[model samples]
Target: MSATIVRRSAIMTAAVAASALFLASCSSGGSSDPSDSATGSDSASAPTGVTLVMWHQSADADPQLNLYKAYEAASGNTIELVDLPADTYTTAVQTKWATGDRPDILEYVPTPQDMRQLNMSENMLDLSDLAFVGNRVNDAGELDGAVYGAVLGPLSSFGMFYNKDVLDAAGVDVPTSYGDLMTSCDAVTASGADMVNIGGGSEFPVNMFAGFAYMADYNEGDQWGQGVADGSIKVNDPEGPIVASLTTMKDLVDAGCVNSDAATATFQDSIAAVYDGSSALTILPSDFISLFYEAGGGDTATVDETIGFGPISAEKGIGSYSASPIGSYFVPSTGDATKEAAAKDFIDWITTEGYQDYVDEAQAVPTLTNATTPDLGGLYASLADVLMDPSTTPAFNQSVPGFGSFGQVSVSVLVGQASPQEAADTWQAYVDQAIEAQQ
Candidate 1:
């Protein structure tokens, strides 16, 4: 953020006048400063007059839309965007793909299990050789060690959100651990605010609570994830964290720390409760920081002083890490070499010289070592700090082989249809089925 320089990486590009595309080849160490210019044959250049058809979720707006325009202006290319509803984007992509419909590029989830619907190895380009892949990302857009999607944005961190005034008025410090959390519930109730809010009606938030506790207990959950991936770590284990987490949920409810309408409340309702000072906290991803402030109808400048986000765990200040929040660009195989190379050029441009432009515009945390990080104040700054957590574990879905939801079962616990142990058993059944299908 301190320096302003145009980014120009060494991407060797030759104009294909007839096809109206540039075949750009990039070296790993190309300069990101565009002002430095393309100096060598190994350097890459922005494509000229290439028109790319791209698809993005409808929820994607603002700086995202502007970022694409910036790329078109800087690279002399036209990107025709197709917006699909976020809830149905993946299903629509798959349905269309079944009929041989494919876009030149797509904004999609980068995980292997979630993205497998597209048949990536056979249909998508392997982006391992892209200049930024070696450093800027770990598993954001990777599958089997190769990068498929270009993740040129901030990684989403998982944790709890609290109203600063709510907690302070209750005369309680931020709870360090779940055990620490329990002790403060009485004071929070005395202050006349619900201790926490949940949207079990949506199912995801209920599972999020369980997952938060699981991640804290096993930081860097690679070994446990591997167990789940291979079907050895059964979700039904009587002593598993799933059972414990649900038991904790019941205890909190019995203690009057949670809202009466928890099972019927939606995620939006929970955020509204915290914003209206009806509740003290809600467990959710940091990406939703804007919604809480928006829900309150308060000025944006007061977000930092009014709201705070932190890790919710068995241990204090250590939380879960989920890469799913980091949406990435995936280029499908078009069988046109010229257009294909142009796609790479576009990806190269955004993560390099054009990245700072977006960081300034979107106020995003820079994912790359080379890119300067601006002061991301408010809850965002706290979320950014979570990325630096050395012992953070991957989100539960990280190792799962396909689209599976722990929430699908955990919701039963909230409704009292199943006990914690029973819910775990049902989830384990689903996990076993998914792992077998993989083989």
Candidate 2:
């Protein structure tokens, strides 16, 4: 299945009820730059000599650990950083919360459902009124007009990662729009290489198509997203965005831009196909630059020399947009006042002048205007420009509920089990059912 589908399962797994636990503990981790003075309320104080516990998934090697250690030494309050394993972090956090043991600070992705479950507006400390709030690009952590979380560092964009060597060898330019993509695909294919490795067995292609479709209708997504949330929008509607998106998917497939083994290939298989020089492109998030490198199991320098990322819109003239996650941080109100204040101060420090360092460490686009990112050459540089654009929107699937079903519907369309319209309608039915159940 697609990473979206898999991640959704990861969200709901253990049980729908158990998902409550997962949401309660969801967040992101980051590294910090200590040279710049932290900016925020100086009055926000921690209990002297107290060891504040923080639950996060940031690796030990991240510079944030050192920064926190510095905070501990300077303030005389110990920050006991708990590095939760990726697979069990959600469960562990939820279990701790269930047992009435909550961390002082939480690093998570603040999805709508999770926000509701946590009663975020009421329970999480309101960061909206803080001076640090001014550094944010948008209120991604806002729920019902109250900002409950701090989005750590930067935004990660989704796009196609190309094997630069292969594209160069085939005389293919990096695709900037859908038309360019098709032309590039044709050129690459004519050169006897797979145009792109589509992990059709997974929801990956659907993910890319969703990015394209979402960019096409981005300005209207919030309205339709609310409609979906309230049962007014259905995927199967004749003129719905869902149907339009599915049609785009079909067109890409019919154009013969996809690999022949797409219907059977897994994500890892697609990644390997590109690494071995059999394919030119694979749609993925920017962070996957490292993942692709690690997957290759080679020296980092060699991988950096081979791969790059670029944008692809649904049409010829429009600039491409990709969905990005605003990694969120929260200070739970369940803790004591001293702990809460310290957590707030820690988070506030993260948004200050040196925030760019954390973002660079994460290989993401900085959320702060003053922050700088490393110069990633080639297609990745192009994608970074798109990300820096003020008009860009978050990915649609991430914004709308019930969007995960598109992956399965996409698979059906690929296998001839359903037409694009049929797939759209099926997804609509699923959305309708979900809406009714919520009612």
Candidate 3:
């Protein structure tokens, strides 16, 4: 897939609330009860055949469509696939849901409040009984002990992926600390290359900086989420590490470390810049290594020998790299038992060991603990140590409040529109606002 499509898919998973609101009428009522609600239970009275209408963003449509076909062929059920452009996915889902036209199975990104706000917790089938989904739903995707969604893909880590050739050509070792990373920018630039290529126009890339910084500084497992929940941690707190990270980014810009055009570059363009040798490294998702191979014309053998992956910084004792589960699938609470059963069955089949193998073969990673990592060609084969390191954690972008806006603020820092300090402060304010709004 193109970088733009990848980014859009990630955004769709993260910002389900924003898009849901625009696409459908908000339902205000008590949250649906998974134990006793009509939307929650399976029908015992009759054998009813159901057509499960499913919706997913374009980036996911291809794989999911194939999976659904497998599901139908195996189970003898009809599944209607609705593939919408990633840009329009949220709007379309909301519109369909608002008009009282609901899909039996829906795949979208979810925030904590989405279930209650959209009444999906009440309207979609609850999959708590399914072994695969029942195992993965934490507080992040659940509310009040009920799960509304199932994580569908492999967990992903976010960090700097370097073109080994570029780094080697510049005589710079892969950085092990933030200080080294900042210092190496000049050496990279001196070699007629930019140090990093980030797509600031997209929110997720910017959010990654905050997530990485938080992981770097905080040791408490899930402390970032706790801070947001308790109003103790703010995204922009001048006293916090995220601000320092932002400042460092600003310092790089001042030093001409990143591409001058980075602030406005689309994700695809930025990836292209790295591929064509205009830049040395880029902050990328774990799947990027595989994407890199594809972009180089699917010559895995040729690509495997050249790429490397590492944590977001070289700052030892600070933090390890982290990843979050993005673009998961969820079954909404619906009033029909037959439909609910079918939904759960479909989810179970997809996340099963057999299907996970297919996913690993197709997508390079499987989210389930039972699945094996696919052969990621050569560019990423070298970074296996970094990607699977026990020390790595999930990035806060998937969990932190108000982190979605980090990209815009980072862009401002890069373009001199906002001082790093101001950007940090703004982020904290956003966190505070989000906490209050959620409460």
Collision count for each candidate, in order: 13, 10, 24
Cα lDDT for residue 162, candidate 2: 75
lDDT of all predictions, in order shown? Answer: 0.68, 0.60, 0.59
Candidate 2, residue 194: lDDT: 84
Write model 3 residue lDDT over 149-183, tens digit each, in one string: 77655445566667788889999998756687677
Model 1: per-residue lDDT, tens digit, 294-365? 765647667667778888786555777655423478989999777787787778777766776565445555
TM-score of 3: 0.77
- Residues 97-160 of candidate 2 have per-residue lDDT tens digits of 6776677877655656445545676567888766666655545566777777776534445567
After aligning candidate 1 to the native by TM-score, how far in Å is the CA of 4 from where it should be?
34
Candidate 3 regions with alpha-carbon error over 4 angstroms: 1-51, 61-65, 83-101, 110-120, 133-142, 317-327, 334-339, 362-384
- In candidate 3, residue 111 scores what lDDT? 47
When superposed on Cα atoms, how far off is each prediction in RMSD? 9.1, 10.2, 11.5
Top candidate when judged by lDDT against the true structure:
1
Reference-based lDDT, residue 412, model 1: 74
Error of 2 at 159 (Å): 1.7
**What C-alpha lDDT, on a 0 to 100 scale, does residue 219 get in candidate 2?**
31
